[model samples]
Target: MTPVVSLRGVRVAHQGRTVVHAVDLDIQRGSWFGLVGANGSGKTSLLKALAGRLPFSGGACLIGGEDMIADRAGRAEQFGFAPPADRLPDSLRASEMLAFVGGHLDRVRRNLGPLRQALGVDPLLDQWIGNCSAGMKQRLAIAAAFAGGQKLVILDEPFNWLDPVAIFDLRLALRQMVDDGLTLITALHDLHALVVACDDGLILANGKKRIDLSHGMLRDAAVAPSLFEKEMIDILRAGAAE
Candidate 1:
């Protein structure tokens, strides 16, 4: 079967400086994929490119067999994204913001019931986004992302500001989504969560693709957190040395 998402020789640049080098990748259908990288390693850049927020300077991005850049509406219909916490609008109420971000998509409206139930957003609906606590904001953001019943969901730094209980709840929610055939991708620093949740993961260092770990490799790392942390650190170190 064709991959759900594909990147070929992709390159991204900002302000005349290249941030993501030529990179190639494929994300399978119905799988939870993880993107890992140190600060400024181009993880967000790649996600933005995939989300159509940023234009790619070279190569191609395909979503569900359609060229992502060339087929804007198709790409938009196929994926939903949750940006970082700091990027959410503070001016609107939680309900207003969620509506503003996802209201146009029919899938979002159709899928909102499950998201509302899972993220527990009813209490925060009337609250102004700026007034809500950090955890509240994060929960709303998550609700907004999963609200779209797109084939693929991309989330950046999803666990930020979440308490232990919220984190546990979110993980269960993600697992349920995957079980229901949603393709999930996230760029996160929570190594333990990544290992526990993702079937596959890629590590980026200095805008370069450094390592791709399969399910067994990721599961193995979970046996010892330090081992996985050390491996990520080593990848970054290697990139820095180059």
Candidate 2:
């Protein structure tokens, strides 16, 4: 089967500084994939590039085998992207923000009830975005992303302000979403969470691929936490030294 998402020699530069270098990646359909790296290592940049939010300087990215660069709108329609909470607008109410998301595709509006319940966002609908806490906003953003029922979801630093309980719920929700046949790619800081939630992991160091481990290669749940953390820390340390 063709990969749900594919990047070939993808690169991204910001203000003349290349942050992501020639990355080739393939994410299988319905798989949960984690992009792990230290701050500034280009995990977020790569995710944005894959989501077609940023134009790559070279190579190509395809969503469901369609060239993203050539069909920006069509490519965007295939995935729901939620940036970090701080990037979301502060002026809108939760309802307004959700409406904006629904405007993009009718599926979002149609699925509003179930998504709101799943994210525990029903009570937050009337709150002003600026007044909501970080965790609340994160939840709302996540809910809005899935509102559209897009086949692929891309989230950048989703755990930034989530409380412990929210984190726990999010893990279960994400796993359930994947089981329901949607592909997920998230940039996350927690190695343990990644191992628990994702079937595969990709490590980036100084904007380049350092490790790509599939589900079959990862250790069992019992040993994964320690082993994954050690490997990630070693890569970060090596990147810092370079």
Candidate 3:
């Protein structure tokens, strides 16, 4: 079967500075992939490129066998992209927010009750999202992303404002989605979350991917964490140089 997403020789630059260079990646259908990195490691850029939100220098990114360069919108709409775009209506209730998401794709399933509980947004669903806490906002964002029921979901720093329990619930929803055949790619900060949620790991640093490790290796006592930290520093220093 064709991969849910594929990228080869992908490069992204900004203001004459190369951010991501020659990245080749493949995300299998129904797999949950993790991206681990420090700031400026090109994690967000790479995710955006894969989501077809950024133009790349030289490469092909195929989404569900459709080339993004050739048909960007059609391909992009097939995947759920919850960018940190602040695109939500602040005054809307959580239920109203999900209603908007449902309306976007003409979905009749306005039953956000279950998902709200699953994502732990039940208590805050009727309140204005703008007045909610940061974790609540994060949960709302995630709810919208999954609301559309797209085949692929790409999330960047999705754990930014989430509390520990909310984070775990999000992990549960994500894992359930993968098991149900939706491709997932996420950038997260907590190591414990990553350990529980992902199988294979991709480590990015200095605008490039430095390591791809098995779940066992990532959980190793003297292996994955050490190497990942080193790569993260490399990325941080590289950013400082620039």
Candidate 4:
């Protein structure tokens, strides 16, 4: 089967400075792929470029066989992106925000009921976004990402501001979604969560691909998590020193 997401020599730049170097990747349908990197390692920039929210150069980025940059409107329907909580609109009610972004509030609510319940965002739906706490906002942001019933969802630092219980719930929920045929891409800082949730992942260091963690490797890491984490830390530290 063709990959759900494919990138070849992908590069992203900001202010004429390239932050994401030439990179190649492929993610199969129904897989949960993780992006791991330290601060300023280009994870966010790469995610934005893939989602068509940022401009990129040097190669092709195809989502479901279509050019992501050229067919952004179609891509929006295929994937949902939940950026940082601070990017949500403060003035709108959570429900309104979902409707604005996802279109058709009723359909969004019906399609994303499970995710909303899992995220504990139902109570905040009627509340203005400005009044919600960081955790609450984060929950809403996650729910909003799935509001469109997208086949793929990309989350950046989704564990931020979430309590331990919420984190656990989200992990379970995301796993279930993938099992039910959702393609997930997440930029994560929490290695524990990455080991627990992701089937495949790669480490990014200084705008370059540092390590690719395959499914079998991650499965082994799941059994011996600390060893995996140590390996990642050693790599990251080495990358940082360079």
Candidate 5:
């Protein structure tokens, strides 16, 4: 089967400075892919470019066989993205914010019922986003991202600020969604969770792809989390030195 998403020679720049450099990637349909990188490693930039929130150059970004870079608006409708919680509108209630970001209030509402319950954001819907705790805001943002009923969803550090139980619940929910044919991609800092939850992953260092972790690699990583983490650190260090 054709990959659900593909990137060829992809590059991203900010204010005339190159960030992501000549990256190529493919994400299979219904797979959970993880992006792992340290600070200023271009993970966010790549994710933003893929989500059509940032302009990129020098490549083709295809979603479901269509070039999304050439027709961002049309292809972007097929995916939903949740940036860091700080990007969320604090002035609105959680419900209003969801509707704004998710589009089609009725559809958002319809899809949010189960999502809100799964993410434990039901009680927070009426609360002002400004007043919600970081964890609460995170739950709301996640719920909003999923409420759009998109085939693909991209999340940035989604497990941040979530409690253990909440993290567990979200992981289970994501696994179920992927099994049900949703393609999930996330930028993650939690190495253990990345090893456990992701079917495949890419590691970046200084805006360059340092390592591509396959399914077998992730399975091995799951068995030796510390070893995997150390190896990743070594790879990142090598990249940084170069």
Candidate 6:
């Protein structure tokens, strides 16, 4: 089977400075892939490149056996994005935003399923977008991304501001997608959460790609609170020691 997503010699830059090196990644269909790194470590940049949200240098990004940049709409129809750079229109209700995205996406609406039963908008679906909490809005964002018709989803720091139970719910939700043959690439801060939610993860450091850990690796790493805290602290200490 053809890879769902592929990048070859992909490099990204901002204001004429390189942020990502010559990186190549192949994400198989129906797998959950995590993108993890420190702030400004180019996780977001790589996601933007993968999602076709930004331009980069020297690479071919493919979606389901086709070139992404060459067949823009076809590739676009295969993916959805949460927190998609543009902010929500403040005057719209949660439902209204959903309708708008469904309409704007052209051919993607046919793939959407029903919204979550306990949507973050449950208490405020009737309220304006401006009034919701960050967590609530983030949920709505994921809801919009998974709008269902697409086969792939790209989420950047989606767990921000969510409570513990909400985190678990999100994890289950992503797993459901994988079970149903959907592909995912999420950017996350909490290494533990990424280790928990993703079946495989891509670790980016120093504008380079490191280990691409599988689910078994995540399970064996003791990716609980203490190990996570220690790793982060070590990153800090190593920076200081340098």
For each candidate, give its TM-score against the true structure: 0.90, 0.91, 0.82, 0.95, 0.94, 0.84
Off by over 4 Å in 5: 103-106, 112-114
- Which residue ranges in model 6 land beyond 4 Å of their true spot? 69-74, 84-86, 104-115, 222-242
lDDT, candidate 5, at 49: 86
What lDDT is reached at residue 227 by model 5?
Answer: 95
RMSD of each candidate?
2.3, 2.2, 3.4, 1.4, 1.6, 3.5
Candidate 2 residue lDDT tens string, 1-242: 79878888888888899998888888999899989888899998887766667767887888778777555566667778885676678898887887788764344545543445556776887899999988888888787777666778888877777788777777777787788887889998888777778888788889998878688755564376787577679988898578
lDDT of 3 by residue, 1-242 (tens): 67777887788887788899888777788888888777778988887766667767677877767667545566567767774636567878877877777674235133332455766755766788778776677777877777777878888888787777776776776787688777888886655556667766677777887766565765672356656556555654665465
Task: List residue ranges in candidate 4 displaced over 4 A.
Answer: 69-74
Clash count, candidate 2: 1
lDDT of 2: 0.78
TM-score, candidate number 3? 0.82
What's the lDDT of the predicted structure labeled candidate 6? Answer: 0.71
1 or 2, which is superior by lDDT?
Answer: 1
lDDT of each: 0.81, 0.78, 0.71, 0.86, 0.85, 0.71
Candidate 5, 1-242: lDDT as tens digits: 79999989889999999999988888999999999988889999999888888888768898889887766566567778885787678899987887777676677866654465678766887899999888988888788778788889999899999899989888988888888888999999889989989999899988899878999999998889999999998887888787
Q: Rank the candidates by TM-score, best first.
A: 4, 5, 2, 1, 6, 3
What's model 2's TM-score? 0.91
The candidate 5 region of ten consecutive residues with least summed lDDT is 109-118
* Cα-based lDDT at residue 148, candidate 1: 56
Candidate 2 residue 113 C-alpha distance from true site, Å: 7.5
lDDT of 4: 0.86
Pairs of colliding residues, candidate 4: none
Winning model by TM-score: 4
